[model samples]
Target: LFSAVVAPFLLASIPMLQPDLQRATLNALLQISAQLPVNQTSAGISVTYPPEDAWLTSRWPLVINMLWSLALVIGLVTAVFAMLVKRWLLAFQQKRDNTLPDDVDGFREQSVGLRKWGVNLIVGLLPLCLHFAIAVFLIGLIPFTWHVSKALGVLVSTLVSVGVFLYGLAALLGHMVVSCPYTAP
Candidate 1:
């Protein structure tokens, strides 16, 4: 979240602070202070970005876009993965609890149970693993996704990978807590 919001704000604010990049703007507070005396109001000073040197017109916009887009994609992927893990866990629990009829032949009953487990395992795993793989794949492709500074690309990708990995580990821990029963020693 910080990387998505604060990082872009940093890009916009840091450059503005640099003397070399200073652009002229009408100070609204100053205008208000002056107007307070006579009620002669300048409709709050508007500090509009020039059409030529607008913030979005610059490379910073692309960089910021890339940063936030990566953050959003990774975030959504993490949610999907956590859900998948939870689904798989629930299926396993269900299979474990299911009981066959006493009158049914053991061989046929065993085969049926095995088939059910197999279907559940495949159903639960396919989407989970596919989404995870795509996320990892896109993280690698981010740099090539746009033309941006190599350093920024590499930096964002590294940060994203680390963040995603830690998020996944946390999800795994959460799965463990939910799937396993607590037993006092």
Candidate 2:
């Protein structure tokens, strides 16, 4: 269910995970310091310079793409894990027509053991993958926001930091508290 909701978002983000070639070209062209004024007047013309292009030249794109790639892989792995577990459970639930004398207790124990392992593994890892993917996406988003707007970048970075911090706190609490209901990987 969670994968159904998140898969679309992860897939949709594929096109946006690329570096901006136009921006990169413009940054390259703007590297020259020497330039003539576009307009001249007897009173002297004023020229405005754009903000530093360091962000474009830096490795932010590579870092962002790498993070997105990791998130995508994690999402795919989680989806596959979910499907495998579901199939296994369904197989276990299927009726068997064996008429030979069988030990009910042994069959029950085997079934229960397999079911417990599958359920525990899925429960423990699904949320962990989701949280990790979100964190990676948010981390990648900081550089993207920075490219769009510095104020927005700051806002996003702060919010993401807070979110990650809270997630870490929750995980720690879950580990420390025996009665905690939250699942942690």
Candidate 3:
């Protein structure tokens, strides 16, 4: 009963794992910055200053810090979400076994359907959702690369973000495959 009622709710909440929309917005800003010209000085004593690029030539430390922080937060959030899902499933199984009537075949059927549906939905959605997230994070790299100092930080953040997303996806897939009903020969 608990898995039937709660798994869908939990799965629907996966998008909330990425609570900070600021990361996507920052990525958009960086993408826009990539279109502008680089800062350069003309030959001779003359000096030239182009209009400050909104995306490039900004305080990179701040940007890098923000990106790394967002990645870390996202990773933690995903880990928590996975843990909660596992706990919920375990608790539901225990409760169902304890409380279900011995003759209630209909209840068993319904529980099987709910579990199958929830796992199927998660397996179908995980890849699409994480792929979009990774694309957004990668977009933030455009402006970060313009500065040598921020480049390393950006790379680290990007790798961590991608790694966490992949990890979560793998977990979801594993759950689906492992919990799938088996057929007898």
Compose the digit string of candidate 3's lDDT tens values, residues 42-100: 33233333444443334543554444344444444544556666676676577677765
The positional error of residue 13 in candidate 3, measured at the CA in angstroms, is: 30
- Kindly state the number of residue pairs that clash in model 3: 0
Top model number, TM-score: 2
Cα deviation of 44, candidate 1, in Å? 28
Q: Which portions of model 3 miss their true places by more than 4 Å?
A: 1-66, 96-101, 105-137, 149-185
Ranking by lDDT: 2, 1, 3
Model 1 quality (TM-score): 0.30
Predicted structure with the largest lDDT when compared to the true one = 2
Overall lDDT per candidate, in order of appearance: 0.52, 0.68, 0.51
TM per candidate comes to 0.30, 0.62, 0.35
**What tens digits encode model 1's per-residue C-alpha lDDT throughout 61-180?**
455445445554655565566677577667655654564445346545555775776755655564565455445445434543333467777777787789778767776666778764
After superposing candidate 2 on the true structure, give the runs of residues whose Cα lies further than 4 Å from its correct spot. Answer: 1-52, 95-102, 105-109, 112-123, 178-183
User: Which pairs of residues collide in candidate 1?
Assistant: none
Better of 1 and 3 by lDDT: 1
For residues 95-144, what per-residue lDDT tens digits would candidate 2 score against the true structure?
33232247676567656878667686775677688778767767777877
